[model samples]
Target: MLDLYDRRIVASLNSKYIDSKLAIDTLALALKKHSPKPGLLLHSDQGSQFASQEFTAYCKENAIVQSMSRAGCPYDNAAMERFYNTFKNEYICRYYFKTDEELNLGTQDYVFVWYNYTRPHSYNGGIPPSRVRFR
Candidate 1:
């Protein structure tokens, strides 16, 4: 997964399995590259990935404030939710992954090359994210 901030991919990772501590570590490593910039308001759902003790500890260590929505409220993380929905609908659902590497490479291409450089986002003045970032 790649974390998007100001439409730039700050980090990238390949996850065979998703674990809370791994997620925290990946995020922390990424944030370390941009340290002293206030802090991240890490928002997530009540999933185990965000609720784990290790994850919370990492957040505290990094001065990241954790924010979660009320139970059953998806809108709280609506941007991510919408992105996932569009990703699955437009890419994953239509493709067959013969290998994990293939899937990872395809995802990298989609996020970095296609989504950021080609696809236009309405929220970003109807231009691709890459252009907006340069602006």
Candidate 2:
């Protein structure tokens, strides 16, 4: 999940399936990393995983408010879309992973080391996301 305030990727997971389990697990990671107060707004695409009963219940249990983008409207969740595009073009597409473990480790480095700390984001005034977030 991407935190809008600083354009930071708060949590992420890689899986062969895009089911409720993956969604819940990713959210759980974000929650563990940053314990945001109740009533946090989680904006996501209108995917079945996000709308599944288990995911919905999980959000409610954590006092998170789930908001879905309008049907077929990517603009509603533009930041996430943009992030995915950048990630794909800048990182994922550049390398061919030989194993899931390699991909996961590479992704961790890209997100935590390069993207958050080294890469400059225009929305964050050309500074890295971590700088904007921690400043």
Candidate 3:
């Protein structure tokens, strides 16, 4: 969900069905479109998703520097933590999803189309993520 260069969220979905390998591959694909230069700093906590062999290898192959926060330090990943909190509060908190499919679709719609194109972000000078990127 972290858009590294833009410092905005790229996408989010509610699904425990995603595996670490798939997450890694998805990130690589997104990065390909947004960051082709490589060598970007990808900071993440030591979650299995970030620490998976596929992810590590992708970083290595792409010339990205993978930075892991120290264990037990919430502040180390404050941005992502704050993002999740906002996501939950704004979207997840209000909805009672009856099924995984519903949650997945709703979250995808919020984070991708609405959040990116319509929602104004205070942190980005009150512009939507899409405007900040394209304008």
Query: In order, what is each prediction's RMSD in angstroms?
Result: 2.8, 1.2, 2.6
Task: State the weakest 10-residue window (summed lDDT) of model 3.
Answer: 6-15
Q: Between prediction 1 and prediction 2, which has the larger TM-score?
A: 2
Kindly report which residue stretches of model 2 are placed more than 4 angstroms away from their true locations once superposed: 133-135
Could you arrange the candidates by TM-score from highest to lowest? 2, 1, 3
Among the numbered candidates, top lDDT falls to 2
lDDT of 3 by residue, 29-112 (tens): 667557757587778888887888887888888888888999998988987887788788999999899998888788878877
Q: Give the Cα-based TM-score of candidate 3 against the true structure.
A: 0.81
The TM-score of candidate 1 is 0.81
lDDT for each of the candidates? 0.73, 0.96, 0.75
Candidate number of the best TM-score: 2
* lDDT over C-alpha atoms for residue 70 of model 1: 84
Clashing pairs in 1: none
Task: Tell me the lDDT of model 3 at 26.
Answer: 64
Query: What is candidate 2's lDDT per residue for 6-109, written digit by digit as tens?
Result: 99999989999999999999999999999999999999999999999999999999999999999999799999999999999999999999999999999999
